[model samples]
Each structure stands twice: as structure tokens, then as C-alpha cells.
Target: MEKRRIQIFDTSLRDGEQVPGCKLNAKEKVKIAKKLEELGVDVIEAGFPISSPGDYESVQEISKNISHTTVCALSRAMEKDIKIAGESLKYAKYPRIHTGIGTSNVHIRYKFNSTLDKIIDQSMEAVKYAKKFVEDVEFYAEDAGRTDNQFLSKICENVIKCGATVINIPDTTGCCLPEEYGKKIQFLMENVKGIHKVVISTHCHDDLGLSTANSLYGIINGAQQVECTINGIGERAGNTSLEEIVMIIKQNPHLNFFTNIKTQCFADISRLVSKYTGMKIPANKAIVGINAFSHSSGIHQDGVIKKKETYESINPKDVGVNDSSIILTARSGRAALKYRYQQIGYFLKKNSLDLVYSIFLKYADRKKEITDKDLETILEKANLIKNHSSRLSSDISRHVI
Candidate 1:
């Protein structure tokens, strides 16, 4: 089967920066953009030029430095916003103007306070005006997750007709389930008149903690591009995490899609964003998290000790992570304990394990984790006792401290 290639549009510098305290300086933004380019993103949505003067400079500086990835500037449907976006990317070799407005009735009525007809007209004008600046124009419909399927389809159709090279459907609120979001993409693929003229893209949020799932679903359905941020940092919960989305498609064969991302760079990118943004990644975060591949339970640890493939779905090396952690705790099995002991040069046999039980009890009483160093010290004392007279019996009964 032929695998479809999905364009990864990294929004780490733009939407990811919108998160509180995640604001990066122009220097930081340029630094990240260079890394994003090295990570092989198809496009880097640098910043919203009209949002602030700082944003404009950051986008411009990023555009000047980035050579391979297409530099994109976000803008509202207003002419001023699109103009600022174009001005910001004047030096970009491959520039794209990503401009759009809300297409959902809720946004049309409550947010924009305008009629649907006016919404379509304004969206078209934005795309057309943006075309004057750059050949690549991407149109986005915010809150596309909750938008009426038929109306959203029309917005995509007209946006493409107006010269949008790509149509971005954003689940801005992360409100939809995976199945519903998938169906929504399928609907756009089946209904939009001009859908074939432009690539369909997905920009899903993680408010409900399913951004990566929904984005993958979009790819599985029909979305040819995915808008994501490093470490999943963005407004609210976040946009689709670039690491999560990339790992998912790589690990799941059923998705039938591929991207150009350098998967091995995933960890470094996550760490860089987390450090710059000051938002520490959750230990349970997919792919790049510290505990993503950690095993502690007895059954799982035993399986992992037997073979890493038994417990881990993806290889740590693939995503630049060091290795799976075989954490030792009360739930750890003898096999894991033996494996850990061997790591410290202690090859304990069954009889030796019986002797070690008393030491284990003492160690468990005082500490939650029995470090190899601690185990070695305990054994060293035991070996001294064996030489003294008794065969390292619990006669001395020193605490496992």
C-alpha cells in the first residue's frame, strides 16, 4: 500500500508561545526555528504578525534564518493583518500567508457578530489579498471542530476557490471525540467542491487531552497536513503535540501516513521548548516524557526484562530518548531485581536471593528505591560476615539503611 505523506506545520513558535510564560524572545524564536527546520517540519508557523510588534520581528527574523522549511506568518482575515504578515516575511525564500477567520456559526454570530455571507466574503478577500504577497496561502477556520459540517465544507470550498493553497481545519477548542473529528475530515473530503484543489490540514487543540489522537484521526481520514507544537505547548491545553502525532503515525501502521520529521530529534526539541517556555513536560506525556517508557510493575518489568519489545511499543532510540527505565520498587519482580543487581555486577543465585530477602526487607523499610549502590554495600557487608565466621547470616541483623 502507498503511504500518504502528511505535512507537519510546527506552530511551536506561534501558538505554542501563546501559552502563559511560554513567550520566547526573538533570539529564542530564531533558535527554535532553526531546530524546527533541522527536525524537518514542512512549514514553520512562526508567529502572528499583527498580534504584537515583537511577534512581527520574531517572524521576520525566523523567516530570514530558515532556509528549508516554508516560513509562514499567521494573520486574521483583515487586510492589515495580512499586510503585516507579508511584510514580516519579505526575506523568506518560501513564504506562506496563513490567514482565516472563524467559520462556525457560534464564532460567526457570537465572536465576529456577522452573518455567514459576510464571513465567507471576508475569508475570500483575505485569501485573495494574501496571494498578492506569497504563492503559498493557507486559510484556516478557527473552532472548526464544532462548526456545522456542511457550512465548514463550504468555507473550505470557497477558500480554495479564492486561491488558498491549503485549507486548515482547526479544532481550536479540542471539543470533539476522535471518531467525530475523523468523520468531520471525511465529510470535508466528500463534500467540499474545491477540496481537491488544495491540501486539507488539521490544527487540533488538546483541551480534552486528545489533540494527537484527533490529529492522527484527521490524517487517517483525509487531512494532508497537521498543525502541531513541540511538547504539545500552545493555548489552553495545547495544539497537537508534534512528538505525539509523529510517534503515533510512525508506530501505528493502520494510520497509513508518514511525515518528513526527524523522529530522532524529538527529545531534544521537547527539552528545548520546555526549557525556553518554562513549562515542564508532564512525566506521562507521550514519546518524549521521562516516564513514557519507564516500567515498574512486577508483571510488566518481568516482561521487559525478558525482552524490551514485550513492554515497549516504540524504540527509545527512534525518538532520541536514552533507554527504557526499569525502575525498582515494591512492585518489581525477582527477575527485575536480578537484572538490576547484575547491572551493579552482582549475579545473585536462588540461594543468594534467599539471603538477600532480609536485606531487601530492611532496604524496603527505609527507602522506596533500592539503589544498586545500596545493594552493593549490603552485599559487601554480607561478604565480610561470611569471611568472619558465619556465612553472612542475618545474625548481625544490620538495618538495610
Candidate 2:
């Protein structure tokens, strides 16, 4: 079967920088935008141009600097916002105006102070207005996860008719489960008229920690584009981690979905975002975390040492890290000890390995972990090397006599 190419629409600069203290200046955003392009994202959502002068400049600057990747500017359903968004991307070779309105009843009434009919009218008008400035237009149905599927399908069909090249169904609050989100996308695929004429995209948040799952489910059901951030930085919890979803696609070839992302650049870009945003990556965070490829448990270390595939489904190098680690602690088994010995140029036989492991356990109990120097001391104290040396000398003397 032919693999489908999934467009990676990175919103790190716009949505990721939305975290209260994680804001980046125009220069900083351009730096990250260039890196995102180098990392092979299909589209970069530079900023919400109508939000502020800083954002407008960031989008304009990014659009000017980036030539290959499509640069996008976001806007609300308002005419003024869409006009500003269009102006921000005037310099972009490939530009898209992302404009939309809320679809769910909650947003229609509480957020917009309007009804669904009005919201649909606004959504269509927004797309039509955006199409004036650029050939590419993305219409987002904000909170579509909770919107009535039939109504959502009508909105998508109408927006496409209004000349939207892509329809973004965002799980704005991250409230829906994978099954629910998948069904919503599937419903659109089956119900929306002229669905095949435009790309269906996903924009999911991590409020419930299921953004990655939900996004992938949408792809499985029919979505062709995914909106994500570098380290899941965004409102409330965060958006989907770009590296996570990309790696998931890479590891699961059976799904026949692939992206243009340079997987090896994930770690570098992850650190760059973390450093600039001042958001620390958790130790257990998947893919690019410090402990993502580190092993400490006895059984786990043994399995990893024998065959990495036994314990790790994804190779550390595949995600840009240099290599995996075998952490030596009190719980480390004989296999770990043997591997550590070989690391320092000692190849212990099975008999000698057992002896050294006995000494290692006692030494490990008194200490937190055995470093290379500590292991060398343990090996010397075990007397196995001395015994072998003594036997060699005795054999030499016998032959000489």
C-alpha cells in the first residue's frame, strides 16, 4: 500500500508562545520559525497578527524569511482581524490566512454572544474574506470536538464552498476522548459534501493528556494534517507535542502515514524551545526527555543490554539523541555489570562475572551507584585477574624448567 503524507502544521510560535510567561519577541519567533522550516514542517503558524503589533511583525518577518514552507497568520472571524491577518502574510511566497469562528454552543453563546446560525454565517464570511488575500485559506471550527457532528459537517461543507483549502477541526478544550474525536472526524468524512476537495486538519490540545492520541485517531479516520507544538506548550495543559506525533507516525509504518519531519532534529529543536520559553521538559516526558532512553531497573537493563528492542520500541538515535544509557545502580543485574565492565575494556568470563557481581552488590549497597573508577576498584579487589596472572606465571615457569 502507498503511504499517505501527513502535513505537519506547526503552531509552536503562535499557540506555544501563548503560555503566560513563555512569550517570545519577533526576533526570537523568527529564529524558531527558521528552525521549524529546517526541521521540515509543512506549515508554520507564525502568529495571530491582529492580536498585537509584536505578533503582526513576527508573522510578517517570518513570511519574509521563509520561502519554501507555507507561512500562516491566524485571525478571528471578524473582518478587521482577517484583514490584518492577510496583510501580515503579504510578503510570504506561500501564504495562508487562518480565520474561523467558534462552532460549539458553549462558544457560540458564551464566547461570541451569538447563535449557531450567526456563527456559521461568520465562518463562511471569514473564509471568503481571507480568500481575497491569499489562494490558501484555512477555516477552523473552534471547539468542533463538542459541536454537533451534523452541524459541524454543514459548517465544513459551507466553508469549503466559500473557498477554504483546509478545514481545521480543533479540540479547543481538549475535552473529548480518542473515540469521540475520531468519530467526529469520521462523521465529517462521511457527511461533508465535497470533502475530497479540501484537506481535513486536526488541532488538538493536551488538557486531558489525550491530544496526541486524539490527533492520531483523526488521522486514522481521515485527517491529513496535524497542528502541534514542539513540547506541547500552549493554553492550559498544552497542544500536542510535535515530536510525539511525528515519531508515532515514523514507528508505525503499518499505518502507512508519514511526514516530512527530520526526526533527528527533534531533540535539538525541543531543547531550543525549552530554553527560550523557560519551560522545563519533565524527566519522563516522552521522546526528548532526559530519562526517555535511560534504563535503571535490573530486568530492564538486562533486556536493553541484550537487545534494545526488548525494552525500547524507539531507538534513542532515531529522535536525535546520541544513544541510550545503562544506568548502574544497586538494582543493576549481572548483565549490566558485565556490560559496564566491557565498557572499560574488561571482558569478563561467565565464572569471573558471577564473582564480580557478588562483590558489586555489596559495594553498590554502600554507594548510590558504581562509576567506572569504582568498578575498576571492585574488579581489582575481586582477585580474579590476580589469580589468572598467577596461573599464567606458573605455567610459564613449568615450561621454562
Candidate 3:
């Protein structure tokens, strides 16, 4: 079967930077934008230009440097915001203006003090105005996760008719379950007029840790674009992780979904985002984490050492990692010990290994991890180094004779 290509719309420089204390300057934003283009992101959401002058400059800078991928600027459902966003993207070869308004009841009543009909009107106007500046216009229905499906369908259809090429359904609060989000997308696909004329995009948050799941479900239900950030950084809890969604679609061939993403650049971009943002990626983060491929359990290490596929579904090199690690811990067994020893050019006979294993256990119990230096110390303490050296000399002499 032909694989359906999912456009990866990266918002790392925009939404990802919304995390508290995680801000990037224009130069830093440009650096990341260039990297995102290299990583094969289909669209790069540069920034909300009306938010600040710094953001406008950043978006302009990214637009100037990025030529392959579409450079998108975010805007509210207001003429001023759309105008500024357009001005910021004047140099972009492929420019998109993302403008939208709240459609959910809570946003309609409290956020905007308006009614459903007015909200739809505002959404249509925003898309119409944004279309004047860029041929590619994406309209976002803020808080669409909680918006009534019927009303969501109405606004989405209206935006599409008003020249919007992409309709983004964002679970702004990150509250929707996978099934709920999937059904929501399905409802739009079945109900919205001209839905086939525009791409349905999924913009999910991770407040409930369901962003990635919801995005995948959205795709299964007909969403062709996924809005995500590197390492999942964003407002509040976060957004769908770009690496997670990309790797998921790549690994699951039966899903028949593919993207233009360079999977090998995951680790590099992940590190760059973390470094610029000063947010330390948890060692347990999926895909690019430091410990994602590290094996510490004796059974797991032994199995992985015997066959990589025994414990790991992904080849470390596929994500730019050199190899899987056999970490020496208290739970490690003889096989892991032997493998680690061999890695450092030490060849221990079964008897010598058995002897060293006993001593290693005692040392392991006292420390969280056993280093290569500790292994050498254990060999010396066991008096096996001298004996092994003598044996080596004897073998050399016999061979010479």
C-alpha cells in the first residue's frame, strides 16, 4: 500500500518557546529554523509576530534564511495581528499565516464574551484577511478539543470557504483522550463541507500526557498534518513531541504513515533545543534520551548483548546513537560483566571471571555503578593481572620456540 505522507508542522520556535524560562533570541531562533529545514520539517511556525518586536524580528530572520520549508507566522483573529504577521514573512519563499479564534463555549462566553455565530464570523474574516498576504493560510480553532463538534465543524467549514488551506484543531488545554480526539477529527471529516479541500491538522498539548497519542489518533482519523515541538516543550505541560510522533509513524509500518523528517537528526536537534532552552531532557525521554538505549538490568543487558532486537526495537544508529550501553550496576550478571570487560581489552577465563564476579558484586553493592577503572582495580586486587601477564609472556615464549 502507498504510505500517506503526514506533514510535520514544527512549532518548536513558537509554541515550544512558550515554556516558562525557555526563551530564544532572534539568532537562536534562526539557528533552530535552519536546523528544522535540514531536518525536513514541512512548515516552521516562526513566531507570533504581534506578541513582541523581538518575535517579529525572529520571524523575519527565519523567513530570510529558510527557503525550502514554509515559514509560518501565528496571529490572532484580528486584522492588526494578521497584518504584522504578514509583514514579518515578506521574505519567505513559502509563507503561511496561521490565524484563528476560540470556538469552545468557555472561550466564547468568558474569553471573548461573544456568541457562536460571531466566533464563526471572526474566524472567516481572519482567514480571508490572512489569505491576502500568503497563498498558504492555516486557521486554528483554539480550544477545539472542548468545542462542540457541530460548532467546530461550522467554523472549520467557514474558514475553508474563506481561503484557509489548513484547519488546525488544537487541544489547547490538553484535556482530550485519544479516542475523543480521534472521533472529533472523524466528525469533521464526515461533517465539514470542503474538508477534502484543506489539510486537517492536529495541534495537541501534553497536560494530560496524551498529546502524542491524540495526534496519532487524529492522523488515523484523517488529520494530515501534526503540529509538534522538539522534546515536546511548550506552554504549561507541553505539546506533542516531534520526535515521538515522527518515530512512531516511522516504526509502525502497518500504519502506512510517513513524513519528510530526517529521523537520524533527532538526537542532534533534541540536544540543540535542550541546550538553547536550558531545559535538561530527562534521561528517560523517549527516542533521544541519554538512557533510551542504555541497558542496566542483567537480564536485559545479556539479552541485548546476545541480540539487539531482543530488547530494542530501534537500531541506535538509526537515531544517530553509536551503540547501546551495557551499564554495570548491582543487578548485572556474569554475561554483562564479561562483555564490559571485553570492551576494555580484558579477556578473563571462566575461572578468573567467576573469581572476579564475586569481588565485583561486593563493590557493586557499595556503588550505584561500576566504572572501567573500578574493573581494573578489582583485577589488581584479585592479583589476576600479574598472573595473566605471566601467562601472556609464557604463551609468547612458547610460540617463539
| Candidate with the greatest lDDT versus the true structure | 3
lDDT, model 1: 0.87
Q: What 10-residue stretch in candidate 3 is worst by lDDT?
A: 392-401
Q: Which runs of model 2 end up more than 4 angstroms from their true locations?
A: 349-359, 362-369, 376-401
Give the TM-scores of the predictions, in the order they appear: 0.93, 0.91, 0.96
How would you encode candidate 1's per-residue C-alpha lDDT over 1-401 as one tens digit per residue? 89999899999988988887667999999998999999999999999999999999998999889888899999999999999999999999999999999988889999989998999999999999999999999999998998999888887888888899999989989999999999999999999887888898999998998898898889889889999999888998888989888888888777678889899998898898898889999999889889999998889999988899998999999999888988877777778877777775456767676676666657766788777667666676556344322344443333322
Best by TM-score: 3
Candidate 3, 220-246: lDDT as tens digits: 999999999999999999999999999
Task: Report the candidate with higher lDDT, 1 versus 2.
Answer: 2
lDDT of 1 at 58: 96
**Which parts of model 3 have CA positions greater than 4 angstroms off?**
386-401
* Model 1 TM-score, all chains together: 0.93
> What's the lDDT for residue 182 in model 2?
95
Whole-model alpha-carbon lDDT for candidate 2: 0.90
Separately for all candidates shown, the number of backbone clashes (residues 3 or more apart, or on different chains) is 0, 0, 0
lDDT per residue for candidate 2 within 137-204, as digits (tens), equals 99999989889998899889999999999999999999999999999999999999999999999999
